[model samples]
Target chain A: MLRVDVEKQLGEFSLHATFSSEGRVTGLFGASGAGKSSLINMIAGLLRPDRGTIVIDGETVDDTASGIHVPTWRRRIGYVFQDARLFPHLNVAQNLDYGRRMNRLAPDAAQRARVVELLDIGALLDRRPGKLSGGERQRVALGRALLSKPRLLLLDEPLGALDEARKLEILPYLVRLRDEANVPMVYVSHDAAELRQLATQIVMLRQGRVTSFGGVKVLT
Target chain B: MLDISPAEWTAILLSLRVAIIATLVATPFGIALAWLLARRDFWGKSVLDAVVHLPLVLPPVVTGYLLLLTFGRRGLVGGFLADHLGIVFAFRWTGAALACGVMSFPLLVRPMRLSIEAIDRRLEQAAETLGAAPFKVFFTVTLPLALPGVLAGMVLGFAKAIGEFGATITFVSNIPGETQTISSAIYSLIQTPDGDAAAGRLVIVSIVLALGALIAAEWFAHRATQRLHGN
Candidate 1:
């Protein structure tokens, strides 16, 4: 369960967005500067809304009335940036292990092995991020995000940087993550094709608010 | 005839030791300051920016005097350290390092700030959603993305420390093998008619050291950028 009703003003642009969903994958489709990223940032707790409330898994993550705002790191939410910002200093293996190490829980080697196999990135473990190709980098980024075992995932244009071939290669992995991983996710994108393959629900935005939000079958 | 005296070699070694220590001591501080300037906006930001760059703009003597007032033996903080911890810093090699670190801190911080600012903030937000604490994101995402700048800053700081003279000499004085450094050595040599050859050798060494640092910075920045973009 992910709910957001955030209003923030970034300079001249006023972001007033409200939405709620429990879907496995919810796509937020909007043009550049339409406040899509801003709304996403609010959910991530990186940007504070002037007023609103966000609840995830029945817990109020952000609420102005109660003055409760969870910091981004403690939100149990995962976000994937458009450019796949993998750590340059860390190799592919360390990059994947970062979230796990940070979770501070006892090491779950069996679960770790499953994610490694699911992502099919075991072979690229020893290589540095600089050595991987565009598609491989995105996969490593995806694997890194999943290894954290997020309760909710936020992907902000994860495919925006790749070329056509790279997109094709990584699209299947995202689809698998959505369908099989079963984690609730918020995906922001402008490309119709990507939404077609990955999004289960579509939340369209124009200006700074949601224009329409419904099952992807409507857009399809 | 022997090329140099034992005192001369000690000065050389002392200079090297002080500069290295200064840089090492300031590296973490430089990164933290850079992160603050780049990521957060708060009250008196402009004042902080100016204060950090004070050593770059003020005369070395002035900077040294200020350091002496704050960190000199029997000085404010220095007095406390001397009284309680028995740590002495007046006219010592440690004092030289303090001066060098202060003088070169801006060099270490500016590049880091620029690189940190250049990084996409969205990635950090993404890490946050993935259950990364602020410190973890800093170490994993923010710091990694800003590595090029941090590396460049460190190299520049090290270079600046190596070349530093004014504040070092003013703060610790030219104490022969205790506080003398490359630039101080060169300055002392130039004062005498027969010391030209030694000064020239140190000059060549300076150039070589600076050139090497620049080359290494370039290689590191390139490799880091490639690794980040997964190129």
Candidate 2:
């Protein structure tokens, strides 16, 4: 479960959002500059909210009134950006293991094997991010994030940078993630059709405010 | 066949030692300072930046004199160090290395800072979300990516240290076998009537060493870029 009620003022744009979702996949549907990314960033503990609280999996990660703010690394959240920001210097396997190692979790061969097989990235283990195609990089990025064992996953325009053909190729993998990964996800995208296929819940935003928050039918 | 006098040989060995020591000593500090200047925002950031680059603009002799005031035997830091740590820098080869290190610090920092700044912040943020602490992120991601710049800085520092004359001569004096590096040795030889051949040979050696370091730096930087970019 993820709950958030926050307000932030960035230049002329002010973001005031309040929503909570227990669904497996919560889609943040908004156009460009609709504060979707900022909202998700706040939820990830990457950005602080001016006023309000954010609770993730029953733990209060951010509460402005009580001055409780957890650092991003301690929040146990995974974030995938639009650019699929995988570590270029590290190969696919090393990149996937980075989060686990950083968190000081002992090597789990079973978990590692499961993630690699789930993403069908077994062949890419030896390859660097630069050598991978657009769809492959995102899949690797998704695998990397998943291996961290995050409580909440934030996907900010994960498919925004892909072409239609590439999107079509990766959509099924995303559906697998939503149905089987067990981790709750907050998916941010401007594409309604993509959300319609994957999201169980939709939070619609317009100019930094949540105009609607409910089932995926709200996206219609 | 090339013939070199014993004194010129000593000078060559001494120059190499001083330059190598100077570069090695300055590298860690240079990287730390460059990271601070590139990624941090502080109240006296500009002042610190200026201070780091002060040796570049100041007369080498003046810089040496300031070092002398602070690091000489009777000076504050020098006295404390000599009395407590028994580490003397006045009129010693180590003093020459120190002078060279100070003179080349700016050269070691500029390229490093630029490279560190050129890194995408998004990568760091992603690392953070992946549960890497700030320090871990730096070592795992930032340092490897900034390696090319660090190598360039080391080369620049090494070249500067080798060619250093004014600051070293002023701070440690041109003592034969102790502080007289290749440059000072060449200067001494040029003053004698029959020392032209020795000075010429030393000059050629200096040029070769500097050129070698430059080529190595470029090659290493290219290799690092290729490895990082996976090309």
Candidate 3:
């Protein structure tokens, strides 16, 4: 479960969002500049909330009153940005292995092989990120995030950077991820259709406020 | 034909030693300062940046004099170091290295800072979310990406240290074998009546070293550009 009640002031806009979701995939649905990214960023611990608390999996990751703010790395979360920010110096295999090495987790060849096969990225392992196509890069990014064994996965417009054909190419993989992966996810997108297909619950936002919250029907 | 005598060879070897030692010693401090300048915004940031670049604009002789006062025998830091650690920098090869390091620092830091600045900060955030702490992110992501620039900086610094004349001469007084580098040696040779031939040979050596360093720096810069482009 994820709980968030946070207030932040950014220039002229103010964000006072409050919601809690027990859904396996909570789709944060909103238009551009509607604070969708900001809300998810707060959950990922990338952006600190000026006020209130965020609890992920019974752990209070952030609480302004108690001054409990867990840093991002310690949050044990995975984030996939719109731009696939792969390390240029590393090949795909190394990139996938990075988080495991950093976390000092014992090498799990089984899990690595499973994720690679799931994403169909085995052939691309030796290639540099620069060699991958747009869809291929997103798949690699997704695989990289999954291999970290995060408690929660936050994807901000993962498809936002892709073209229509590329989006079609990756949506099936995402659906498989939702059904197969044990980790809960917070998928943020402005596309209602995409949310309708994936989100078990929807939190609708407009101008930095949660205007509505419910099942996929709320997207309409 | 290059007919270099033993005295000239000593100066050449001394120059290489001073330059190498200076470059190696200053690199860690240079990388730290470069990262600080590139990735941070804090109080006194501009002031720190200006201080890092001070050697480039300040007269080398003035920098040397300041070093002498601060690190000379009987001076503040020098006195403490000598008394406690038995390390001395006054009128010695080590003093020449110190001077060269200071003189070459700005050149060493610029490329590193620029490369660090060029990195996509979002990538660092990605690393953090992937369970790498801030320092881990630096070692794994930021430093590797900025390696070409680091190499460029080191080459530039090494070249500058090798050719450093004014500050080195002022700080260590151009003592042969102890402090006289190629630049100082050439200075001495050119001043003597029959030393023109030796000076010419040393000048040729200097030109070759400078050209080689320039080429290496250029190559590193090219690699830096490619790395940034993710190619």
Candidate 4:
């Protein structure tokens, strides 16, 4: 379960949002500058909310009134940015192993193999991210996040940087992730079609406000 | 004409020792300062920046005199250190190294600061989301990515240290084996009546060392640029 009721002031724009979802994949649908990213960042503990609380999986990650704010790393959440920000100095295998190392998790070869197989990134493991195509980089980023064993995965337009062909290539992998990964996710995107295909519940935003909340029907 | 004497060899060897020691000792402090300057904005930041660069612009003799006051045997910091730790810098080779390190610090830190600034902060955020704490993010991501530039900085610092003359001579005085580096040795030789040939040889050695350092710094800087491109 993920819950958020937060107010933030960012210069000329102020975001006031409240929503709770237990859905496997809660989609935040909005256009650019619709505050979807800000909302997701708040959940990830990257942005502190001026007022209100955020609860993830029954744990109070952020509560402004109580002055409880869990840092991003301690929150045990995964984030995939739009640009697929891979560490340039590390090879794909090292990048994938980074989260496990940082979290002090025992190396699970079975889980590693499973994620590699699921993402079809085994062959690319030895290559640096600089060598990967856009689609391949995104796949590697997904594998990197999944191997971390995060409670909640926040993806901000993972396909936003891809071309049409690359998007088609990666969408099926995302669908498989939704069906099999077993991690609850907050998927943010502007395309209604994308949300309709993946999101079990939809929260629509416009200009920093939640305009609608419901099933995928609200996306239309 | 190319013959080198034993006393000249001592000066050459001493110069290398002073420069190598200075560069190694100053590196950690340089990296820390560079990261602070690159990633943070605090009160007195500009003042700190200016202080770090002071040695670069201040007259070398003035810097040396300040070092004398702070690190001399009877001076404030030096007196305390001498009484407590039995470490002394006044009129010693160690004092020469200290002077070289201070003079080379700005050169050492510039490349490091630029490299840290060039890193994509978003990558650090990504590391944080993946469970790396702040320090881990620095070691694993920021430091490694900035390594080439760090090397460049170190090489530049080493070059500057090897050639440091004014501050070193002033701080430690030109004691023959204790504090006389290549530059001070050359200065001494140039003033002597029969010292032209030896001075010429030392000058050539200094030229070679400086050129090598410059080339290495250039190569590392090139690598730094490429590293940022993710290649």
Candidate 5:
């Protein structure tokens, strides 16, 4: 379960978003500059809201009234940016293990193996992020995020940087992560194709406000 | 008798020592300052950034004097350090390092800050969503992406330290066996009769060292960039 009631003012464009979701994938659909990213950023704890309450899985992550704002690290959320931002120095395997190691995940090799095979990045593990193609990099990023075992996965247009073919290639992995990982997700995108193929819920935004929100059926 | 002249070898060894020490001392500070300037938005950040770069613009002698006033025996911080910790810095090799580190700090911070700022911060945000803590995101996503710049900064700083003359001479004074780095040795030799031969040798060494630093920085930054571009 994810609930966000955030109000932030960036210059004159005020973002006041309030929504809740418990779906496999919740799409924050909007046009460009519609505050979808900002909304998602608030959920990720990257941007603090002026007044709001964000509760995830019955945990009060943020309640500005109570002055309780959990830091991003403690949020246990995984975010995929529009651009696949992988560590350049670290190879694919290391990048995937970064959060897990930092968070001190248990010494469960079985779980690690599952993530590697799930993303099908076993072959590319030894290669550096700087050496991979766009599709390959995004896949590795997805794998990295999944390895951390995040309770909430925030993908802010993760496919935005890829070409058409790369997007097509990587979209399935995202969908699989949505279905198989069983982790709830908040997805931000303007593309309808991804919404149809992935989103189980939809929350539409315009000018930084939640304009409409309903089932994936509304996407049609 | 040692095969190498005491003056020549001592200067060589001291130069290397001072440069290494300066690099070690400044690198971590440089990276931290760069990251702060790049990522965090706080009050007086620009002022802090300007202060970090002030050594580059200020005359090295002025910087040395400032250091002296702050770290000198009778100086504010210096008096405390000496009385409390019994540590002495004036006219010592450590003082030379202080001078060198100050002179080279800007060269280290600039490249690093620029590279860090150039990183798409959204990616770091992404890492956060991936359950990476702030520190983890920095160590994993941000630091690796900013690495090429960090290496460039280190090289630039080392090269700058090797050539540091004004601040070092003013802060430490060119002692024969202790604080006499190559540039100071060259200055000392130039002031003496028949010392042109030694001065010329030290000059050549300085040129070689500085050139090597530059060449290495360029080569590494280029290669790292290529790798970053996935080529």
Candidate 6:
């Protein structure tokens, strides 16, 4: 479960939003500069709101009134950016293990093998990120995030940079993740069709305000 | 055949030792300072930056004089160190190394700061999202990505330290078998009527040593860049 009610002012733009979702896959649908990424960032504890609070899994990660703010690393949330910022110096296997190591968790061979198999990245483990294609890079990024064992996953336009063929190649894996991974996800995208195909619930935004919130029908 | 006298050999050896010590001693501090300058915004940041680069613009003699005032035997820091720690810098080879280190510090810091600045902040943000604390993100992501720059900075510092003559001569003076480096030895030989042959040999040695360091720096930087970019 995730709840967010926040207000932020960025230079000439202002963002005021309130939304709550218990859905496994909640989609944030908005056009460019519509504050979709900003909202997700706030939820991930990457950005602080001037007012209101954000609760993830019943923990108040951010509460302006009480002055409670959890740092991003302590928030236990996984974020995948549109660019898939993989560590270029590390090979795929090391990158995959990074989150787990950083969190000081005991190496879970079973979990590691499971994530690699699920993402089908077993073959690319020895390869570096620069050698991988865009779609492959995103898969590695997804695997890297998932291995962290996050309470909630925030993906800001995960497939926005890919071509149609690459999107087609990765969508099924995303669907499989939603069905099998069991981690709650907040998916952000501007494309309504993609949201319709994956989002269990939809939150619509227009110029940094949530105009509508409901099932896939709200995307219409 | 190369006919190198024992005195020339001693100067060559002492120069190598001083340059190596200076570069090694300053590298960690240089990286720390460079990282701060590149990634942080605070009050007096510009002032700190200027201070760090002061050695670059100031005349070497002036810089050496300032160092002598602060670190000489009768000076404040030098007196304290001598009284408590029993470490003295005045007219010693250690003082010469200190002078070289100060002269080369700006060269060590500039490339590192630039490389650190060139890194994508998003990558660090991604590391944070993966549950890495700030320190961990720096070590695991930021430091590794900035390695080529660090290498370039060290090489620059080493080269500067090896070539450092003005500040070193001013601070430690040219004493044979103690503080006389290749540059000082060459200067002394030039003053002697029959010492032209010795000075020429020392000059050749200096060029070879400097060229070797530059070539090694370039090779290491190229390899590091390739590895970082996944080439």
lDDT of 1 by residue, B1-231 (tens): 436556556766777788789889999999998999998899999999999999999999999988888888868999999899987778988999999999999988988898888777766765666677778789878887788888888888888888899888888888777788888888998998998888877777789888998888788678666645654
Q: Estimate the overall C-alpha local distance difference test score of candidate 4.
A: 0.95
Residue A193, model 6: lDDT of 89
Deviating ranges (above 4 Å) for candidate 6? none
Per-residue error at B115 for model 6, in Å? 1.1
lDDT tens readout by residue for model 2, B8-56: 8899999999999999999999999999999999999999999999999
What TM-score goes with each of the models? 0.83, 0.98, 0.98, 0.99, 0.87, 0.98
All models, RMSD in angstroms? 3.6, 1.1, 1.0, 0.9, 3.1, 1.1
The regions of model 3 sitting more than 4 angstroms off are none
Q: Which stretches of candidate 1 lie over 4 Å from their true place?
A: A8-19, A27-36, A106-123, A129-134, A157-172, A189-217, B65-80, B145-148, B182-224
Residue B161, candidate 1: how far off, in angstroms? 3.0
Which is superior by DockQ, 2 or 6? 6
lDDT of 3 at A75: 92
Q: Fraction of true inter-chain Cα contacts (below 8 Å) kept per model?
A: 0.76, 0.82, 0.76, 0.78, 0.68, 0.87
The sequence of per-residue lDDT tens digits that candidate 6 reaches over residues A1-220 is 9999999998988999999999999999999999999999999888999999999999999999999999999999988889999999999999999989999999999988988999899999999999999999999999999999999999999999999999999998899899989999999999998999899999999998999999999987
DockQ comparisons of all candidates to the true complex: 0.54, 0.78, 0.81, 0.84, 0.53, 0.82
> Relative to the true structure, how large is the alpha-carbon lDDT of every model?
0.83, 0.93, 0.93, 0.95, 0.85, 0.92
**Who wins the lDDT comparison?**
4
The worst-scoring run of ten residues by lDDT in candidate 2 chain B lies at B222-231
Error of 5 at B156 (Å): 2.6
Candidate 4 lDDT, tens digit per residue, B37-84? Answer: 999999999999999999999999999999999999989999999999
State which docking tier applies to candidate 6. Answer: high
- Write the residue-wise lDDT of candidate 3 on B191-214 in tens digits: 999989999999999999999999
Interface RMSD of each: 2.6, 1.3, 0.9, 0.8, 2.6, 1.1
